[model samples]
Target chain A: MEAIIAVLLILMIAGSIYTLHARDLLSAIVSYGIVGFALVIIFLFLKAPDLAIVQLVVEIITLIIMIAVIRNSSKEDLQERTTVKVEGVHYINLRSALYLLVTGILCIGLFYYFVKSIPGLEPFGVHTTRMATTYIEQGAELTGSANLVTGILFDFRGYDTLGEATILLTAVIGILTILRIKGKKV
Target chain B: MTLFVLCFILFLVGMYGVITRRNMIKIILGLCIMEYSLNLFFVLIGYVKNGVAPIITKGTEQATFVDPLPQAMVLTVIVIGLATTAMLMAIAIRLYRKHNTFDIREINTLKG
Candidate 1:
């Protein structure tokens, strides 16, 4: 099981890297879908059906929104425009190369420190539960729901859900405002 | 152990995208990647070796269930992520409409 999960994680990493570097915006968005779907499978493997369902639906909606934006935006990349065409032969710019080198070094250093800091946390698959033990032990009885996840979400932590709904409402209002045909009166 | 490290690496990959990429849509994609990795990490932390989904169905009353707290939080985060993504997309579309390009480097104007 662990080996399977490791493979999926590697796949997700590769997909994300590809997404960031893909030449075509459409292809990048598609690769991003791959990462999201891999996450859905991983969620299932981790025994979180609730998350899997939510992630799957959200992933699809996100792809639709992104694709719509990409379709309406300029397709040509600035990097492609900057390519130096010397006698019909393209040459890479030195500035982009230098930027890549610097970013790569910084990311590697950050990854190294992150790995070093992982020792402070508990080992995987052995959660301490803390207060969650009660949530699991009596979640159904307290909330009268078959699904413990739903029970805890709507019962034990109902305020958080309320805040989330408010955030969604704000996002909708903000989007409507931003996308208005006219921002100010003439 | 390695899974946790890889999850962080996924996050760094997203950071790389946001920091290095100049396109507005690319930046949004980077943000999405970072969001995903963080959610995955949270769920990963709550995983048990041999656990079932956190549902209290008949005949499985005593089953060891994965922690429900993170799952619940992630569920909300996922929905909120959709909302935020839509909002970001709206802004990006408007920016493209005003500037006629998605490249952030080219869209440099404060005056309407």
Candidate 2:
């Protein structure tokens, strides 16, 4: 199991890096989708079926939305406009390499320093936290939901969910307001 | 443990893309990558060894379950991310229409 997880993590890292450096926008988006799929597998392995389900659906929706946006726009304009040219070379320069080196070193050092303080991985299948125990024991009785995650999302933390819904609605309105054609208000 | 480190590395990679990429769309993709890595880290924090899903079934005895709180929180975060991504893409389209280019280096109308 550990080996499988480690391999998946490695794959995710590779996918992210590939996506970051891919010259084609469409290819980068597809690589990002691959990373998202790997994340779904990780969520399932972590025993969070709810998250896995949500992630699968969300990933597909996000990919479709991004592809639609790309399709609707002038791809040739973007391709020609965004490409960087330095002398005879295109898209590779000294500045990006320096930035990559600096950021890579800084993150490695920061992560190493902080990760030492984190506790080691606990044994699998055993949640030692008190809150988790409490939630499991009393969640059904208190919230009348078969799924504890649903109980927490809708009952225990209903206000937060309400705020989330508001945010979503605001985003939709904002998108419509921004994208509406001029002189034709929706 | 190692998983946390990998997630952090992914975050840094996204940050690198955001800082180095001049294209507006690439920057937005980097932001989405950072959001995803952080969400994965949050969910990993609550994972238990040999834990089952938090769904309760009739006449079934389950010994352990992954923490439901973080799962719920991440769900909210994911939806929020979707909305924000859509908004960002809309803004990107608007910017493209106004400037006729997606390169951030060339869009300098607001420069004082």
Candidate 3:
């Protein structure tokens, strides 16, 4: 399971990088979907079926919306100007390459510190939960649901779910407002 | 530890895209990538070896279950991430309509 998950993570990284460099806007959006669906599989391997379901549905909707928007606009990314032609040979501009090198080094250094700074964390797949023990022990009995994740989502953390719904409502309203034909009548 | 580090690298790739990309859609895609990495990290932290899904059934009443809290939280996070992505996409469409291009450098209006 861990090996499969590691492979999927690598696939997700490759997909994200592809999205960054894709020339066609539609292909970039499709590659973005690849990262999301890869996540759904990882969630399943980790024994979080509820999250997998949610991610699957949400990813489909997001892809649909992105594709709809892309259809009505330009298909080309137009960010391909990063490369300059010098006497028939294309070279990445100096400033962009420099920025990439610096940020790459800094992020790698940060990743090193992240793993080293937290020596107390139980290694992957051997987690010791401080609060989840109660949830697992009595969740089914208290909530009368077979799924503990659902019990916590709707019963234990119902208010947070409500807030999440509210945020979605606000986003829809905001999208409608922004996409309107006119912001203010002249 | 290796899984965690790889997840962090995913995040850095997203940050790099957002910081360096010139297209509006690419920046939004970067934000989406960052969100995915963070959500995966949360789920990874909750996993347990030999643990089954957090669903309680009659036959497996005594079986160990993975942590349920992060799974629940990630459900909410996934929904919220879609909301934000939709919002950003909407804004990007409106900007494209107004400016006639998706290039951020060409959309600038503050230059004198």
Candidate 4:
């Protein structure tokens, strides 16, 4: 299981890098899709079937929307643009490269120290779940829902779900308002 | 443990993309990747060894189940991500229509 997860993580990293570096817009989108699907697999392996299902569906929808947006713009137009120029020099110079390297190392070092400082965290699994245990043991009795996840989502944390629904609705409305064509008034 | 570190690395890669890339779509993709890495990290944090799914079935005896809170939360996060991605894509499309390009460098009409 560990080896499988490690492989998947490596694949995800590679896919993201490819997505970032791909010159062509279509290929970049495809690489991003690859990363999304790998994430779905990782979720399944981590025992989060609910997340896996939701991620799979959302990944497909996101890919479709991105592709549709890409289809509207021409490839040549997207490629002809250059980076920000400073005194006739491109932004991707030695200074920016060194800055990126230093920042990456600093962030990784800090994260490593923080992870080491945390006590009682096992290597692979065995997380101590106080609330989760309570939820599992008394969830059915409290909410009368067979699935504890469903019960928690709809009954226990219903307000959060409601908020998420509202956000989705607002996003749809915003998209419609932004994409609508304006008629000229003579 | 190692998985968490790798996830963080992925997040950093996304950050690098967002900071360095000049294309608007690539930046959006970087943001999406960051979101995915964070979601994965949260789900992994809730994993238990030899754990079954959180769904309860009749006449089944299970001792351990994965934490359902992160799963539920991630479900909401995924939907929220979809909405945000849609909005971002809409804005990107509008930008393209106005500027005829997706490059962030050239869409600088507000530069003083």
Candidate 5:
């Protein structure tokens, strides 16, 4: 399982790099979808299934919106755009490349050091699992809920989940308000 | 181990699109790809060695319950995914009509 997961990560990285360089519109969008899906899987391997689900759902919604907007799009060569020429315009260039590279390297380094320093991480997970099992053994008394996950999501982390839901709702509302055909000012 | 890496690679590819792609549709597609790979990863997370379905009954007295929470959440996630997709598609359609062109470079009326 670990080996398989590793391989998946490698593929995801490669895809990301290719996507960065991709010039075509369709291919780039498809590549983004692929990347989102890959991240979902990676989250699973990390034992954060909830995060994975959230990522998957959010990504799908975003993709659909994008597709609908660009369904009738036509490719054309537009005039060359300049960053400095347009005030307050952020354009892509070699400087952006440096930022990306720095961020990527920093993330990689942080992950490596964090893992190396975190000892007995397995034991920690085992402990969490054991705690959950304990709750299961004493079900009904702990949270008055049969489903532990539900309890975990809705009870222990209720506030956090509520926040997430709110964010999603806000995004949906924002999208609707922006794209509504009634022509009301957003 | 390798699978984890593969998933990461897929994520990176999507990132590539997100970072560099200029077309609206392509950006959306890139987002979708990233979402998919992440979902796959999550489903795999709940899997246990030789684990069986979470259902339990008298017939399978010795059966072990695989964590059902992840699967349940996944179902919900799928629905949400569809909803978001619909919304996105609607926006894309509207944008295309308004701009009359798909090239993001041409639709530069929106200023940052």
Candidate 6:
């Protein structure tokens, strides 16, 4: 099981990386969507179903939004205006080379830092699993819902959900205001 | 272990898009990439070993159930992503109308 998970993780990471570097904006969005989906799978693995559901929904919405943006980004511009021909196939520039080198080093460093090693890391010394189980055992009674995830989200950590909704409202309001500027059709 | 490394790669890709790419559309795409990496990170945070689906099965005692919280939240996040994407698209369209070109290098109207 661990081996399989490790493999999936590797695939996800690779896909995400490729998505970022892909020249096409559409491909990048698609790659990012894949990352969101993978994260949903990961959340399931982590015993956070509520978070996974929310994450998936948000990702889907975001992807759609990005597609809309990409489509309109060049609505009135010449397609040939921003061509980036002759990208690194020739002699590599020193600045670009150095940037890649530093980024590579950082990626490797972080990968090792958080790779499923929970040694003496239990500063709380309490089983997180147990707290969740306890929440599950009592969630229905406390939140009046059978779905423990819903209960946890709306009761145990209801504030987080509230914050999320508030943020969405804020974003929509801001977007509407900006679009409503006089003589502006954005 | 390697999966963690993959996150780094995804992050790096997004960063490259943001820093090296001068096109506004490309920059937005890069930002999306970065946001997506975060979503992936959140999902990975909830995985478990030898876990089975939370479905109730006959003749089953206790089974490991993957957390469903993040999954639920991701759905909402996707919606939020939609709103942001729409706003970005609108802005980009406006910029194009005003500037008449997609090249970031030639955007003199917004120069301070």
Of the candidates shown, which would achieve the greatest TM-score relative to the real structure?
3
Clash list (residue pairs), candidate 1: none
DockQ of each: 0.69, 0.55, 0.72, 0.63, 0.25, 0.34
At residue B56, give the lDDT of candidate 3.
82
DockQ of 1: 0.69
The DockQ-based CAPRI class assigned to model 3 is medium
Fnat per model, in the order given?
Answer: 0.83, 0.60, 0.87, 0.75, 0.25, 0.30
lDDT of 5 by residue, A94-166 (tens): 5546646765775577557645644633321122234345434443356776555566567655675676677
Which 10-residue window in model 1 chain B sums to the lowest lDDT? B103-112
Which portions of model 2 miss their true places by more than 4 Å?
A: A72-98, A119-127, A181-186, B109-112
* Of 3 and 4, the candidate ranking higher by DockQ: 3
Q: Tell me the whole-model lDDT of each prediction, alpha carbons only.
A: 0.86, 0.80, 0.87, 0.83, 0.56, 0.60
Q: Which has the higher DockQ value, candidate number 1 or candidate number 5?
A: 1
lDDT winner between candidates 3 and 4? 3
- Candidate 6 versus truth, CA RMSD in Å, comes to 5.6
Q: Is candidate 1 or candidate 2 better by lDDT?
A: 1
Q: What's the candidate order when arranged by decreasing lDDT?
A: 3, 1, 4, 2, 6, 5
Model 5 earns a TM-score of 0.56
Q: Candidate 4: which stretches are off by over 4 Å? A: A76-122, A181-186, B109-112
What docking grade applies to model 4? medium
Question: Which prediction has the highest DockQ against the true structure?
Answer: 3
Off by over 4 Å in 1: A80-98, A183-186, B109-112
The 10-residue segment with the lowest total lDDT in model 4 chain B = B103-112
The C-alpha local distance difference test score for the whole of candidate 5 amounts to: 0.56
Model 3: DockQ vs. true structure: 0.72
Give candidate 6 regions above 4 Å deviation: A1-7, A27-63, A72-127, A130-133, A182-186, B52-62, B67-79, B101-112
TM-score of each: 0.91, 0.86, 0.92, 0.88, 0.56, 0.68
